[model samples]
Target: MANYERKIPILDCGHEYTRRVLHGKWKIRILLYIAEGINRPSELERHIPQATRRVLDAQLAELFKHGIIAKTIFDESVKHVEYYLTDLGNSLMPIVAMMGKWGNTHIDKLRKAINTSTALA
Candidate 1:
């Protein structure tokens, strides 16, 4: 049995559910990479060198649990694993693209604010 659970249940709303599913730091990036055909775990690790393999695996598990991604394992001379986005995940690409566009559009202001906050921290 699980010993840990949220004290407050997640709100039964579309916005809240979406936020819960996409809450992890690396999840969005993982989704984007998988969509771009960087599906192997090792490949993802190479692409996101700042993220530890454990963290990436955890985020991948979360994505899988939420049905946003599917995993495939190939058994040959050597085992291989790959991840792919699900239909639900594919539907989110436009939203993700728009978010990226918005960030690029406001990069100057956003970068300044983020750097300021980091400096303060």
Candidate 2:
């Protein structure tokens, strides 16, 4: 058995707060898809086919709670809802772009390491 010691950080730290907002697996992807104009829940689900509606909805709720995204319920007979990024959410786009850029730059090396580890196992 492996010894799993956990260390906790100060929750009030600004950087930690920011990380909490972007903590979920689907949250960042949801933000990017919204930035790309996939504003509806169904559209987001379609764009992120790997995530189920339940998972996406949970992430969306968290994002909405953190004010990173806003859900607008339309006044229609059929009732429509759309998501828009708040200013804070818009502010995350560049960071996301940079993250993607960094991943792209190092993907070959990262993949090689993962493949080697998998083969070793």
The 10-residue segment of model 2 with minimum total lDDT is 4-13
Candidate 1: regions farther than 4 A off:
1-10
lDDT of 1 by residue, 34-98 (tens): 99999999999999999999999999999999999999999989999999999999998898899
Error of 1 at 103 (Å): 0.7
lDDT by residue for model 2 (1-121), tens:
9997768655788888888988988888899889888899999888999999999999999999988999899989888789999998999889889989999999999999999999999
The C-alpha local distance difference test score for the whole of candidate 2 amounts to 0.90
- The CA lDDT at 84 in model 1 is 97
Error of 2 at 120 (Å): 6.1
- As for candidate 2, its clashing pairs are none
Q: What are the root-mean-square deviations of the candidates from the true structure over C-alphas? A: 4.0, 4.5
Worst 10 residues of 1 by lDDT: 2-11
